[model samples]
Target chain A: MTKTSAGKPFPWHILFFLGPGLLIYFSVSVYPLLDTLRLSFFHESSDGSLAFAGLANFTKLLFDVVWSEPFWNATWNNLVFFFIHMLVQNPIGLLLAVLLSSPKLRLSGTYRTLIFMPTMLSVVIIGFVWQLLLSPLWGITENFMWNLGLEDYFDAWLGKESSALVTLAFISVWQFVGIPMMLIYAALLSIPDELSDASVVDGANPWQAFFYIKLPLILPTIGMVSILTFVANFNAFELVYTIKGALAGPNYSTDIMGTLFYRTFFGFQLQEGSLTMGAAVATLMFLVILLGVALYLFFFQRRIKRFQL
Target chain B: MKNTQMQKATKTIATLAAGFALASTSFSAFSADKLVIESWRAEDTKIWSDIIIPAFNKSNPDIEVVFAPVPTSSYDSALNAKLKAGTAGDLITCRPFDVSLSLYNKGNLTSLNDLPGLASFSDVARSAWITDDGKNTFCLPMASVIHGYIYNKEIFKELKLEVPKTESDFFKVLATIKSESRYTPLVMGTADQWEAATMGYQNFGPNYWKGEQGRKNVISGQEKLSDSQYVKTFEHLAKWAPYMGRSYQSQKYSDSQNLFTLGRGAIYPAGSWEINGFNAQADFEFGAFYPPVPEGQDTCYISDHTDIAMGLNANSKNKKSAKVFLNWMASSEFAELYSNQLPGFFSLSKHAIDLKDPVAQEFLSWRGQCKQTIRNSYQILSRGEPNLENVLWNTSVGVLNGTMTPKEAADKTQASLVNWYKPQQ
Candidate 1:
């Protein structure tokens, strides 16, 4: 290591600190991902052997009606799921974060903790609890609807094909909206008070100061929220599995890639699970995620300048 | 940057060394005297721990028996990972297909011909348990579980309806239940693909279509699913669809069961295994009957030779004790205890015990009167085409949802099965 200007040896201690974590990150996350990608190119033999099957899985997924239809359905549903999160969750989170971050706000910590409580619980518990709450026979949802004077509109939304995906998406959004709220709240907190005061001194109202001064600075955080939402939505499994189950029912209207991968990989009822097909599905998911991340990194992320307060 | 790269290299090497050390140590540790058995059944765990282990420990006290209980939902993936790692317990309980052809081809299971108590099982159970070749006998036929529709006798009586012994009579009662009784006429949930099979296809569909010889005929090219009877089953299913629960295609299994158990629905078609659940609940009482056959069909109820069976591990170190356990499983003693525990569910063993549930007793009395027992079509098709069961179930859901016509559904399933079986040919 080179000597510093002070005649001390260069600070190599940071490397020693980061080395273990970096190794673990690569081995546990990065390596398995690459390995799964590699395995997708191969098919298993009749005698428990494997052979290189380049482009076969992809081609089959596209051309073969049997595979293509279900795969596309899952992919489309996953997109719908992600879109719902973006539309419903992010805006709501932003509003909550903004309201809670108000300087004059009272009991902010308690509100923050309580609002985030659902996110702290496991996805499995949330699923079953919601299932019971929504069951028509149970009448909890119906009771709530009656209270709202909208009892007629309260069908078992979880059971209808047209509504199941949206219902589940909203449930998921309800659970995770806290993450975005907290993140944006922290970003808002970091913004110097001087900047807002200056904007107010220039004859700006509270709303104008927020829209003109604070909003542009927090674009990076909102972008981050969007990217995180995208990832979580695409990778979602437990909620759907716990509630709708592996079949993703109501004619598979709620089926996403996660449930599809599970059903294909494990083989249900009579369909024998095929490992090669499962690997192929995984590879597809990896590609979709990688592509999404790449687009964000190259386009949206680079466009958003992180303003220093 | 240079210092960081050097440090990263060292860390990687250290991790590799540590992993290697752990692997070698665990390798030796695993070779020691221990046998692990994994099963999805929680009830079985208690039996193994309380009853069977003591009997096993009596003979082989040195070898420890470890139990791994897996949840039913995730058992497939959990078992697969364990199997791939070659650490899936010394023995694992499996459904028929998993234990039979799947494990056989994977070479993960061993034949159990040398084990004791191979001769005592009923021939039907024996034939269903073993591979077609005599070389592999992975499981001992444990018990048989019958499945069909369960209706509320009290409700039927209140409606002034006799047990619907024919198709038209069944529909008339369902319409009455829907219109007059302020309850769902039928509780059918196809959300889980298996649920629909339990209701329409597995027991009722095949028998109505091709009767007892359907599988053999389909195998020999003597029958096709597009035949008239197959269409009739779909037509009848469609006719009754309106009376089924709202959005029956999307209803989860438990939700549908809840609806029926809570008295929201008048009829529930489910597996006979649920008799235990109904029996346990004091607030409700229900009776089961096969779905009524079409006119002149002569009342054939769907049946299967294989029920829940247990087999000894071929790799088990304590072979003698494992046999004793299996022998105990097949014995009248085991059947008696199990029947006492779950009143309505049937066992292969000839030991007749008094059933606790009156509804179950009544159902059993009608078994001979109907004189029809149709084997589960999916179970039969599972022998040759691995994908057949899923295709059939998925297609049945589609048909029930009006997504696919009965003929189209049948064709799709047939084509898929043909493709799947092509490799075997």
Candidate 2:
């Protein structure tokens, strides 16, 4: 039908179909990114003017000790946060998915639903709930520990600089692990049962069957999960904002790029907000994410061949 | 067919005519008699629906009154946004003693210099609310908020301790309290960042004497943070760290307040404004005192009057009604109603009632003797730096955690200040 329309030398139908989506994508997504990129090249003036600064903004962000140190600290902290999610969260989610997928398992649907429930809530709500649960004065956590005869180990994890970042990271993982579980579970279910049956008939155990038969089929999904986690972790803001606040205190042990971006752009107490500096940070963040995504797509993804099981 | 077309045309004309008439009437209705006010105070929906709106409605029988209360945290940014959007309300309430100066300089606010009932307020309150140039009554102090330590009298009685009269007494009491009860002796919350700096203003009176002008001189750039008094103030702040809870950095403002009220802690050092929250306790009531400034210093408290002053939006279409409502708000009757109904509040006007809470009233009485010091800590005055409040907050946390020395923290703070401000210059 489209070829016939093209033969008629008028692509009016295609334009009509694509017009709304194109308009929305360009307006909401592309325009803002381009605008932010353009803004990173300029410096803001005191009398509410903007001047072109070329690489000056980037140089300030990198070489200027004050900005650079905090920026790098936030960046490194963000990496640690992302590392925790990938190392701990994804594996746990994958294992849970495997168990839930077992043929002998009962109430798997219930387990999946209950496990995924936390992910459905907003990040801010989850953040505050965790903060309250960990608060020492409330003693709910300590009480639980007391019941378990481990009260000595109980402390305000969120209040200590040593533990705050890890606690927050773990909380984030607890909320978001369901994402990987659902995605991997879907991919696992798509594998033909006959392949697993063949593996079992060949004297392979359940674990072996999963590794050799089903695992190969779900590699694509794992890659997808990694990329999704990369984007979400980098773009994260709400959880930290709601819990640790914009300052990301405990001597800024929990400070991340998102909070840094907000503080830089909006300026807290003595600092005035600078849009140009904010833009520079944003541009740099975008480049980091883009490079990561590109690496995943071009190298890691292509190597992990999907089996047509 | 012709007759039917003629009938359709007639119907269309009638509809358009009706629409035009409705639009014109609505416009005229909007133009005539409307009073709109914007505030940063959280309007308890029940209270507004029952009390305030109806009272205003009764006073201005023919006019309609619209009340909008924005969240306090986002008030400045939101107000600026509204100003940019050209839809700011006729009357806006803000902490005029602080922000009105810059706002006035920008010509975003209107002056209320000639408004009646100016003579009824305390001179201190009047001076605080008026512009420095003396031509603009940019704000009027609604009430004077006196703040100090809110200690549980029951706890002090149990410990057999007297009220601390000096810095050494303060530490001794904390140590005694901690020994008597294994709970945290002094709970200072630094999570909100602003809460951590509450001690900054409390130290203002002491800093004033030591430096001869305090934060005012520092803000004016006549003195630096390295000055002896400033260093001493930072030292005093460091001393309190030992007494604070282990997780003071992580404890939220509300959390620490809750701990004190629940009898888990001995003292809650906070603003007099918290009287409203503290009054909810039926089992234990708090007592107030101006904690001694230092080892040799006399008791001095930092204080500000309870004030919500109305300013007209430069962009308002209904300026006349706005000014009228502001005048009405500043009236004795309005202040009395607000003070009486809103617990922990006392009017700055001559008509202020004697609140029943002895602790709150004690602070109020002490206001006469206490030296009025300006709020400084770089937030209020530093034009270009980001909030150093968090740095101060973290430093206090570090001191409590035994990770930083007071001198080290002070130098770091001074460096941070230079890093943030010097670049702008």
Best by lDDT: 1
Instruction: List model 2 lDDT by residue over A27-116, tens digit each.
Output: 999999999999999988653368999999999899988688888988888999999999999999999999898889999999999999
**Candidate lDDT values, in order:** 0.73, 0.72
Model 2 scores what on Cα lDDT? 0.72
Candidate 1 deviant stretches above 4 angstroms: A1-15, B1-36, B43-68, B245-251, B262-265, B283-285, B313-320, B349-386, B401-408, B418-425
Worst 10 residues of 1 chain B by lDDT: B371-380
Single-chain TM-score of chain A, each candidate = 0.93, 0.96
- Candidate 2 lDDT by residue in tens digits, B281-335: 5268568777566765554646554445667776677767776666677777677
How does each model score on TM-score? 0.87, 0.87
Fnat of each candidate: 0.33, 0.39
Off by over 4 Å in 2: A1-9, A41-57, A269-272, B1-38, B43-54, B77-90, B96-144, B182-184, B200-212, B245-249, B299-301, B305-308, B339-357, B378-380, B420-425
How far is A50's C-alpha from truth in model 2 (Å)? 4.9
